[model samples]
Target: EKVQLLIARKIELFWTRNFSEAIPYNNLVIGVPKEVWRNEKRIALTPSIAANLVKKGFRVRIERNAGLNAMFSNEEFEKEGATICNKSECFQSDIILKVRQPLISEVDEFNEEATIISFLYPAQNQQLINKLSV
Candidate 1:
């Protein structure tokens, strides 16, 4: 079973490298930062979800108090193996998840080539798209 899993992983790696520009889940550092958009009180991830990702070997980092608005405590996330980090540290992650588009200042904090998963309407978010496109 272990050998099969290894072979499958190898196949997945090869497929990603040759076909898609996708990163392996286990190799990703996923960050959940606090929603800073006006009147936004949502978070991208919850403690239970983060815990599942951790179990799958993904590194999860959540900004301190990111879940406060969602009613999910930092302690809950910590107990589930997610690191409670500051804003800068969270934004530095390889994968940043957010409830809405980030502010300009927040965009500057992302490491080069970082991937952000968030809601975006290109027509209304041209500036953000242009910035990220480069």
Candidate 2:
């Protein structure tokens, strides 16, 4: 819990200190996966969050139909200045925020050097740790 809080605080601080530069000036790209697994309906980053990031000058790209199951549409995200992209292009982003770890099938979509962050179910996902080690 302490670690989580500290990480959260660090994220908040990062946004506070660097959001202005990170978004507009640096051409930061963020990727979000379309939910594929069962019972994963929640989107880790919503259009509202995308809007905030854009307001700070960041460019966000999301996988096609990623938010459809969540009742979010491509038009809504586009309205917030986020670009809709194929899974491959989404993985080319500088950073990725995913609700779940990359599945074996989607592993190829990730760029070799991009930073991908996601939640892993350790008990059932030892393979994810190994895959991400790449």
Candidate 3:
């Protein structure tokens, strides 16, 4: 029991702790898009994480040039089995991973059931939240 507790605590430390319904990795496609917010130049996923997810049977799609700001090349992601695609294609994935709140136009292009993980500051982004809630 102590060992189990220790391992669980380690997982918790590295986990996002969404505590929501879990989705099978194989059934989901994770996408990493370029941060378009002015002066905010961070990509959501690293090549290592993409490789790990791919190994776990998840499809990872990264937008072309998405990680340029972070110094991650497409070849790196490709080596990890992630598909380099257009921004629109990336946005259509089952899960969109990003660092900034998406613009309204970008949100409109998201897949109907796509799960987006980002820094969504709801209080400051009421309009974005309203649009997303729709």
Say which candidate scores most in TM-score: 3
lDDT of each: 0.89, 0.81, 0.92
Compared with the true structure, what per-residue lDDT tens digits does model 3 show for residues 27-96?
9999888899888868889999999999999999999999988899999999999999998999899999
* Candidates, ranked, lDDT: 3, 1, 2
lDDT of candidate 2 over 8-120, digit per residue (tens) = 99988887874333345347788887877888887767999999988877779988888988889988898998899998888888888889777876776777777777887
Candidates ranked by TM-score: 3, 1, 2
Query: Could you tell me the TM-score of candidate 2?
Result: 0.75
User: Among these predicted structures, which one has the highest lDDT?
Assistant: 3
Better model by TM-score: candidate 1 vs candidate 3: 3
Name the weakest run of 10 consecutive residues (lDDT summed) in model 1.
Answer: 15-24
Per-candidate Cα RMSD to the true structure, in Å, reads 8.2, 9.8, 8.5
Who is ahead in lDDT, 1 or 2?
1
User: Which lDDT value does model 1 have at 14?
Assistant: 83
Candidate 2 residue pairs in clash (backbone atoms < 3 Å):
23-57, 23-58, 24-57
Which pairs of residues have clashing backbones in candidate 1?
Answer: none
Residue 70, candidate 1: C-alpha displacement in angstroms: 0.8
- The C-alpha stretches of model 1 lying farther than 4 A from their native spots are 1-24
Cα-based TM-score, every candidate: 0.81, 0.75, 0.82
Q: Lowest summed lDDT over 10 consecutive residues: which window, candidate 2?
A: 17-26
